[model samples]
Target: MTTSAILMYVDVWIVLCFYGYLLKIKKRIGFQLGMNISIVMGGMAALLSGVLLITQFPFHFTVITMISTVAGLTVGAVFGLLFDYQTFVTGLTNGIIIGLMSPMIGTVIERPTMFIIFLHGFFIFSLLTIFHSIKRS
Candidate 1:
């Protein structure tokens, strides 16, 4: 398939898998860790979605921003729900702030393909770190 389609699929797949994995370990984590996880997941997912969507639909800036923001907030809220109310709110707030800004970044960046590559690496790195922390505790 095309690059945008591949990136979109990768985004959806990673988030879904991550959500499933979180469900398995929710009982073991505390608010602190939960908040961090939500923050990282929501922010990265929003950013990536915004970039991917913008690259695919260059003319629809506002619509893409809204879509990405909702995606981030939903992902964050779900992740945070596994822990506590406080965690949920924390995640929701972070997701909103980052979501609002993510589209702007997507619009300005000159080299999206390279940026997407680096972002996926960073996102995976963060997820691995969270997984390691969970394993330790």
Candidate 2:
């Protein structure tokens, strides 16, 4: 795997582990917070997967879109399952829409490296936000 792809995969692992942590305390999470968590996780996962996969395999937009969509749906569904059905559906639908659209954004970008770095930073920020929110609840 390329360095960027490796990093994205590592990110996926980190996010999954975070989901595991959330699963342990699912009861403490309210539906609104659950909805937010699912949306953030799903959208970010789709965006990252789409952009990185497109960068790595630029010639295969169709396949990459499918892959990214699945990634988003999976991540969203996993997180949403900890809460409720409404959260699950919301995440799933958001993932579908974002995953479909993200590859085009990837193609239009002038600087993939910088964008990816910023995205990862944003992902970290999102995680910290969720963690703090969880702590507050």
Candidate 3:
């Protein structure tokens, strides 16, 4: 696998493990804590990814960065609202949208290979599942 693909896979795995841990301790802050943490992490990931793309890639930054930031904020806010509003369905729907958009955004910014996109999607969906399980439990 390419370096980027490996990174994406590893990132996903890390996110899954982290989210799992949060779920385990979710009762302390209430069940919604895991979801809250995930949203923050996701937002940070998007921001960091955007910064990385602008710094490391050949892409234009002006529009791409703005788009990425907006996307990140939207996803993050939706995630937060999912927990705050106690709307699991809304969260899942937003997750689905983010999952679909992530790879496309990744490609547009980083131009990663197909494998990278697959890995990205896999991790994102995994994160969604983790949250869903936490909510159900």
Off by over 4 Å in 3: 31-34, 38-87, 110-137
**Structural similarity to truth (TM-score) of each candidate:** 0.95, 0.97, 0.41
Candidate 2 stretches with Cα past 4 Å from truth are none
Q: What tens digits encode model 1's per-residue C-alpha lDDT throughout 36-67?
A: 99888878878888888888888899998898
lDDT of each structure? 0.85, 0.90, 0.51
- Residue-level error in angstroms, candidate 3, position 85: 9.8
Higher-ranked by TM-score: 2 or 3 = 2
Q: What are the root-mean-square deviations of the candidates from the true structure over C-alphas?
A: 1.0, 0.8, 9.7
Check candidate 2 and list the clashing pairs.
Answer: none
Per TM-score, the best of the predicted structures is 2
Clashes of each: 0, 0, 0
